[model samples]
Target: MNLKAWQSLVFQENQQLNCMIEDILINSSNMFIGDQPLRARKIYHDKQCEIGEARLMEDYFVDNSTYDDAIYRRRYQMRRSLFRCIVDVVIANNDYFQQRPDAIGSQSLSPLQKCTGVMRVLAYGTSIDAIDEYLRMSGYTTRDALMNLVDGVILCFGQAPQVSYIVNGRENNRAYYLTYYIYPSWTTFFKLITFPTKKIYKLFAQCQESCRKDVERAFGVLQDRFAFIRHPCPVWDKDNIGRIMIACIILHNMIVKNELDAYLHYYNPTEFLNNMPTNRQPESYTEDDGQPSTFSTEFELEI
Candidate 1:
């Protein structure tokens, strides 16, 4: 509405209005460019942005050998092998993110450090500030690291298109096959199973139920491994949510690939079955009372 302010907004054919506005803003006596009073300061010298070089995040967590295996695993939620694999892939794929020119020419966060920070946040379900102190990065830097890391991971490992299969059974029904189905109770179990004799069928039903619990336990393990998924997503972006989920699953797959052999070695099914006793000892609730443990089958039913 002011006449003098209105006179300055002359639109050019090239439409450089924003640049003109920026020039007008900083040339108002405060910003000094040597003897030239109107010239604005360079971007590198701008007081607003913290784009200069800082401490490396990997220096404390990854390079330092002070942390034990347990501490490292607990913090990162993966073995060193798995983390290294992730870091390698991210470095290979996220080529656009390069160190910028700064005071020391910006050694910014290394690819490993940025990816590690993202993985730690996803694993711990902590606020960005939680990692700021140890990581030596501001909250915004950590946030940017997470966004970029997830983008690269999702792009690198998103599910590929496979040959589609649908067993219609000639009824033209759209249905997907579930990995497993569950029977909620004994009544529902009897309804679904055609085996008439309860005495013979009970053991089979119990075994199926145990397998269902095992499936549920896998999901529980995933939630425990990456607590970010268990918590409500704070970001409103749908694409970002998808990226985060895909990245987490990709990381989980890497962990499985790296650690599955160790798991199989430790819990060899054949060896466990060979050593299994016919009669298992009853668990105790208290040492002296002789009461059944809450972990016992009968006590679990009562609860």
Candidate 2:
């Protein structure tokens, strides 16, 4: 290219780069820069006053309105009492959430609203944007609320006897709890160990599969009932996501408890077993008699 043309092109590119740099610096400065300490302190005081004024609005939002009714349960997938219990526990640890505290801003979100927002994120599996209108919360605020609320709840409910089983693993817990008992049988051990084969292995496998199927069916119902946990979580933070997942499980347990009293009487295993025909004793055999030679009598597995 001609020297003159090259110089012109270079000049234009330099101007464009300068403009871009100016734009970036301006945007970055706006994001990070703020009022000085004195001004900020005054602003903080003003916010505290606003938050204090907003306190009076809380009386209008009684916990009994939707809380005392079935509609609240349907929407949040948790009973009012259980949710209130969460809010109460969370408030005790983090007084910033309470309706009235020894601190500043009157406009801050209440514990109830925070709890509701967190549940909405889990129950609907939606973005923070979804709750803005109903709860009148900004996406930024709601997102922060959700993350903190999950942490707070995990602090409160993470170690409860029921939720303690989360570490024992979900599927294993389901098997232990719902299955009530899993007998020590060859089929149960076959899949869990490295061992020899037997003619009865297929029968044992079938029995194991049947037991697993029962577990699967129960899990399927749980997942289908609570769609929030069934699908891939949209949350970015692994810790927050784990907490939310655990919170949903705790809520699920509470819901199950509410419904259990209605149908628990129908679950009469003793009656059902009594109706089944008794098994016949095997013909007398020695301790070393014609047991399956392929079976490893020494094999004993525990999970």
Candidate 3:
């Protein structure tokens, strides 16, 4: 199909993907702290900022913006406060730590904060102390609190599922059945005790071996691309380190899924089938005192 048709079909079949991409765009923009358009809108033009600042003053905290002499100075402080309030709102809405209230010190950690910290440690292989420092620079208060938040994130990831392929065993199963039942002769039957049950058994072994190799390749990529994971994270806190590992696993899964999906979509099944050799017929044989012997003189000569 053409690209347009493919996209149309995807949109028709999966609205969720479209919605998710939109959400990513919006959330990513909100997460940006630089002097970008989205950040500016959050500070000066957004109605939420006005209400948040009003509530800030009403709650008895000194409103720093009220005393600033210049509009720029006032806007800067207001933007900082607005950004902080937005972070708090994001955390409250997600409720990522509904069960772990202790992590955020009475409030929940924002999703952006949790995700960013997790990704940084996972992607960079940085130490928990380093993650703490990075987050602290962004306004997180304590290393202990960050570590607790990281632990909660890890718990969330542990609950996620591992990916695997489903083999329905159509032609593959038929071939196995033929080899094991219809084609087996007296000599082959005696050899069955030591040989594989069927070609499907070998396929299963090959699949598992391929999976192991894929995992090793993924780890190699991570180590090469992200230098920090090449060595142990220098952080002393185990919880923080665990969260980083979970985040890396999640990223790895995402990459694998994308690659696998592409392979499945574009790969030619005919070519794959052609690459596999035709199954050989079981050799005819005779058995004497439970010993197997083939009639072919070439087999006897080889022995």
Candidate 4:
């Protein structure tokens, strides 16, 4: 339907709302990921509800017209209403969302949800309170309840391996021998080694670093764009506060992914390229005193 028609329909359906949601969807579609534009349109259309459903919703609203009730009903409908069809579409494309738990009730979440929540918390540095608020705002009841849900999500997500060096000599292995090293104790000696497997481990390290940088850049952008976070959020309910924070994190990730994709598409490279070089290369030595340097006294170390 044309924008004008949609606007009129929205007005006729709910006069209290001066503007149509279609405009929000249409205008914001460009800011979204692939196929999101169409999905937004679908959400706008499907969420409108049939006459009978609208009448039922109106009756519910009339019966319970408090602000809290309105908020609850709005959120509930957003999750379960026909308007949520677009959300389903978006979540279907995102394995993270698809794998996340539905509700933080008595039931435990699957392994994937646990891992994803843990990773998200770690990556975002989001406070437990913030997570709780997010869940509550999204329809969860209690902070402890939400924490249990997050625990399950984190368990499902699992812990990523911690990369460290070990001494194992092989052609592909790079080993360093420390004859003596001190760490607040008598001299200790050990051999440290690392192997570049050219496999998932290597890729994971690269992706981990990339994800960290992306999260940092995203927060920077968010802080720049929305100055509110720079100041304290006065909202007292910890659960509500957490929900807002999580929502911001989700939005930030969405924006970052969109920008990254656009950048890749603009470059049209056959392979994905890191924003900065990942390979370690030796720096060329130069004499600062205008004298020829014959010996190199410094070496690069990987932590």
Candidate 5:
């Protein structure tokens, strides 16, 4: 072949090489254009959540378990039956508490384990990492469990005790049974005379002061029952702290209701007075409609 023919063949081969390179680049671009971005694979830690569940059951839940009833009550700050009822309510309210398998088909933590973890945190006010060895849950998992438990408790039991008592003295039926003195002078709030010049005013003040002590003592009982409230909360979030408090109060009410019979049977005046609501003084009157009127007493005094 002539030199021109040889050069032409080399030029054709160069064109073929350029086309191949372009095709390779185009294919690479197409592969990544619409694809999901690469993410680091999650490291799976064998936390053995099942073992945690079994250990919890054997420790307190089983019929012939490790701890006795008194020990269970002291540790959990409530009875076993009440605890189980709360667990059922939580599981029913939120699916997160329901035990389910993870992506790897291994069963995640059980409902009992999640609630037990939460109760441990609330009952003792312990750190999240403190439960790691026995629960086999990471800090993240335990925190998640706490949030879920708060939500569940609030959802299930938050509103039940609110309207439990209906104050019978009001015609409108909207008056609050027990209103704090700090609240505004709405008819709902029972007001006291700042300076009691009259006998009736002095009597009202006495009754109000007595009732206020009952309220304070009720609060004291709550603090005594749950150590969580007695200590400074470790949670950084203000909202979570409030939620945990509300949950603790609801649990307290449930315990009181469940153990009312037993408490009455073993009545101690100090304990009973601390736990129960204040009895209204015999100062209340009745309206023409026959429903009791305002809480102040009828005075027959000659001035």
Candidate 6:
């Protein structure tokens, strides 16, 4: 070949070799590092959340509704009145639960729908998507509602305080009843005797054992009422899980207070009622330091 042609041919061969080397490096890097897997595009479902709110109202909330009080209580895990009260309180405290308009001026889920969605998740321990059919809500929206509802409850009802009790009346020797049974030596704890001598001691042991069962029974009822308490929490964040538990406990206490009359103990309720000091003033509660009431991330990203 001519000198000029030979020079061009060598340059072209070198360029081809460099391109092949570059292609090999890319292939090796891809084999080891790999390209990012494709993420599914979000599918927007036209969940008719307004219709869900109306249906929920018709089924449980309205006067002379489709379902009776018993059915409402069974489904909602609280009386209609109490549910409404909670809805009102949460809506006032957390704007996320309140009904708002979208970019197109379409109304989003109402407070009732959001609260009901969270309630159903807690009460039934069902998957987040399970209520999509009835509530006409997307799973992401329901999960967001759950987080917001719990945050609102913790902010509104959470309290930590220090107090000393004073016994005033002569009834029952003016002894203060111990309500917490965590410590074995505490009055509320039923410690078993190592050895029993007298018949009364044996009887006392039996009575103590029986009373202890009541405590177990109380725990069982709590778990039964809120099935999610017993199940493994799907939330990846530890803080979110703790918030959920605290919120459930607060709700349980509210239910107990609302339905106190339903339980009839043989102990003289009237005597205990009278023993409560009527003139005692209430102390201002010192709020404990906690995480910020609102999450750092937006509601849409909570799930």
Candidate of highest lDDT: 5
lDDT (0 to 1) per candidate: 0.64, 0.62, 0.47, 0.41, 0.80, 0.79
Compared with the true structure, model 2 gives a TM-score of 0.53
- lDDT tens string, model 4, 147-231? 4433333343334345455547524333322321232332332311234376876765565556657867867876553333545
**Cα RMSD for candidates in order:** 12.4, 15.7, 29.3, 28.3, 15.3, 19.4
Pick the winner on lDDT between candidates 3 and 4: 3
The Cα error of candidate 1 at residue 185, in Å, is 26
Tens-digit lDDT string for candidate 6 (35-76): 756689988667767888889889877888899989879987
lDDT of 2 by residue, 1-303 (tens): 999999999999999999999888787755445632435343322234334234423422365342344766777776667777777888889765766544542456566666676677777777777866556556776787777776786677666664224544544333132131343554224352223288576655556668778868876866765666777876777887677777666666667877776566655555444553233223444356666434222333445
Q: Which digits, one per residue and each the tens of the lDDT, describe model 5 over residues 1-303? A: 999999999999999999999888787765565675778999967988888888988998888999988998998888988889888988887988887788999998888887787788778877887888998877777889988888888887887533333447634535354555577877767765578988998987888888878978988998888777788877889999899888888888889989888866454466444554244354567789999866543344445
Q: Clashing pairs in model 2?
A: 48-105, 51-105, 51-106, 51-107, 52-106
* Residue ranges of candidate 3 with Cα displaced over 4 Å: 1-114, 126-149, 160-215, 222-227, 238-243, 258-266, 276-303
* TM-score per candidate: 0.56, 0.53, 0.33, 0.23, 0.67, 0.62
What ranking of all candidate models by lDDT puts the best one first?
5, 6, 1, 2, 3, 4
Query: Could you give candidate 3's per-residue lDDT for residues 1-303 as a string of tens digits?
Result: 999999999888688878888898787866666636643343422222224334434432356534433442222222233334434544554454232444324433334444444444544555544644333313232344445444553444345544444447522211111122345475423112233478887766556556657868877876664455678666666765666566456544544453464466554566444553233344666676777765432222222
- Candidate 6 clash pair list: none
- Candidate 1 overall Cα lDDT vs. reference? 0.64
Q: Whole-model lDDT for model 4 versus the true structure?
A: 0.41
Better of 2 and 4 by TM-score: 2
Candidate 5 residue runs with Cα over 4 Å from true position: 1-44, 160-170, 175-192, 267-303
